[model samples]
Target chain A: MACHELIEGHLQALARSLPASVVEELRDGLIESYEDQLERLGDAEAAAHAAIADFGDADTVTAAFVRASPGRGIAVRLLLAGPVVGLSWAAALIAGHWWTWPISPPLRLAVGLVLGLAVLMLIVAVRERHHYRTVRLAALAGATGVAVLDTTLLATVVMLPAGPSVLLVPALAASVARVLLVVRAVPEMISDP
Target chain B: MRAEALKGHLDGLLLAALEDGPRHGYAVKEALRDATDGKLDLPTGTVYPALHRLEQAGLISGSWVVVAGRRRRTYELTEDGRRSLKGARDNWQEFAAVVSTALRGAPWPATS
Candidate 1:
């Protein structure tokens, strides 16, 4: 069969199994690929057909299309959960110390913002690290850890006596770790196997 | 054929295909074959993913149409697609020129 006919046949088959919009998009993309190839080789239909026969099996193409469509991963789910859990813990920590009202309010607000930012960064890191299995998971863990540390620091700053801000050590450490994890994950996430 | 190699020039080819008006997938393939005199050889399956990516990026829009008792997906260039096509065409021309000159062992021009 002609290359176009072959594609049309596959597209028709795909339409039977997939959503209309998705099938349509796939069809259009396939057509665009045909046009692009036709422009490059000039009168090479037989060669095109052979190439398609060798490399353009319907199953392989469909699999690639499905993979390219961006399914959510564990990292994404963790990213979503991280913020909710982090903020809830931060809120609870602040609320648990009502006796220290005057001092607690400002500290609570500050910690909330810091925790929120950390959570947001975690979410971004997960997204940016979508491809790396280990690094993405590690970044998620680190983000959660930082959020926990921030919550603890808020409580410490509110309840402790005059002392050096020693909690800064772990807080900074966790933030750096999250950033490093995200950076490492980026290249892996973008590299298509 | 690796689609990655063609990625740089796809927008132009797609836009140029659409300049005649919207066309469905099969028709686009046929039109491109006629236009190129059959030089380029792309697999039919590969185009669909690229089309979806383009649509997602807002370079093209598509709709379903019934023709001759079959449903086919038709596509057209968006305004953004046109702009992208122009940019891609210009860039491709410059790139092709440089590559051609280099292949022919010509000195690179200091300025175009």
Candidate 2:
């Protein structure tokens, strides 16, 4: 491949793993850097070789890009998932006997904590947008909230002999689905950096 | 020189490369090579990540400009970058002095 293409390919592949904005910046930077290399080395093929050799491989640069970028935290996805999963359980509860649904103190507390954290996550994701560490932490908090809620629901279902079947079952199922999504996504968020 | 040898010091060197004025990605890499007298030649692609890291850390800043019909991302050191560079240089001096003394078979407290 030509110098530019080689670098472009490397970056394009990384774009698959990183945020588009980051790959775009790296792409522009590399293309310009390639032209500069041509001027310095005075040979297209040799310059291409030098550029590739110096930049390391796709994997190495991608790793660096992942570390430098704010990460592809599934915050956006998780945020979207939250409402849908919550509604699914709500639907189940309403269908089963919404009037009889009991809101225990712990459930109320869990809801308060999740709402607080979700708001904080939204704030960081918006205000301190470029602060990757803070953003990721906020995302983790969201995931943790989901986990705590899911575990509490599961424990309630397992422990309480007289729990309402209609509401608790659907809530537990929805919480389980959310927990699964969080479980699957948490590693990707934390592992990138 | 191997990039491995320049690890923690590379950011300082990169900031120093832009001490004179802002330069595009390649120019900074060129300046790095020139400043090191060609001993610290690194993979050209690796520089962008480092540049991004520096920019993200607010140590430097970058913007795009068209040059010769192509978009180029040029970088310049921020005030924080300059301050960090000064600190890095002082640290380097201390480390270099110790290493130089050791390499020359001088005692730890040898007088100049």
**How many angstroms is residue B110 displaced in model 1 relative to the true structure, after the best TM-score fit?**
14
Give me the overall lDDT of model 1.
0.57
Which CAPRI tier for candidate 1? incorrect
Lowest lDDT block of 10, candidate 1 chain A: A129-138
Candidate 1 lDDT over residue span A65-181, tens digit each:
543442213245446555554455445444455355455577567766766665555555444422333344444454554545544655564566523444444443443444454
Provide chain B TM-scores across all predictions. Answer: 0.82, 0.90
Cα lDDT, all candidates: 0.57, 0.69
TM-score of each: 0.48, 0.58
